[model samples]
Target: MDIFVVDDERIIAETLAIILRNHGYSAETFFSAEHALASIGKSPRLLLTDFRMGRMSGIDLAMEAHSRIDCSVILFSSDLQECDREWQMLQKRDSRCTLLRKPLHPARLLQQVRLSLSTEPRLGLHVS
Candidate 1:
């Protein structure tokens, strides 16, 4: 599946992209929501964004992505409290969005990604 990794931290973005690529997934890294949104038309299967990005937040990205593409979104934040509202909003959307705490265990993150992508039907494009 094609995935977009958006994080202001270059290392984090590149690392996640590398891990996704190693697992046989097509992944790209972006430093901002704007850059990531530019590729939404490509219809990536997943959007992995940092919750505390400088300009545009992950919640905003998720909302825009839901409108523009069929993809599951995984929002990562170091502060769990900061994610509470966004998590609730995601649950309301019912569009397969998940909140992932930062400083994540690589293996655990991968597992969650697998679960989110599997349960999220919109990630796959319908040819018909």
Candidate 2:
């Protein structure tokens, strides 16, 4: 599956990309939403974005991306207290999207990714 990761934090983006790549997935990293959106037509299977980017928020990125192409979006944030708000907002717009608290357990992240991808009908992640 092809995954696009967007984050102002390069380390986080690269680390997630490495993890996804190790799982035999094609991953792309973008430091900005604008840069990533430029290639939105490529149709990534999933999107992983940081919630608190300085210029453009992840929610905005997801919205823009989803408008261009159908995909599953997982929004991550260090502020766990904001999770409920994030979840509610995303669910209102796209239920297939998920909000994950940052400093996430790698195992849990992978598991959620597996489950989300498998269950999402339009993205075609083919988790098996």
**Clashes per candidate, residues 3 or more apart or on different chains:** 0, 0
Best by TM-score: 1
Compute the lDDT of residue 49 as modeled in candidate 1. Answer: 89
TM match of model 2 to true structure: 0.86
Clashing pairs in 1: none
How displaced is residue 76 in candidate 1, in Å? Answer: 0.6
Q: Model 2 scores what on Cα lDDT? A: 0.77
lDDT tens per residue, model 2, 1-128: 48898899899999999988888888899998888888888899788888788787888888888888878888888784655565566667776677777776778778767766674363322111
lDDT by candidate, in order shown: 0.80, 0.77
User: Which residue runs does candidate 2 get wrong by more than 4 Å?
Assistant: 83-87, 119-128
User: Pick by lDDT: which candidate is best?
Assistant: 1
For residues 19-66, write the lDDT of model 1, one tens digit per residue.
988988889899999899887888888898898887888889888888
TM-score of each: 0.88, 0.86
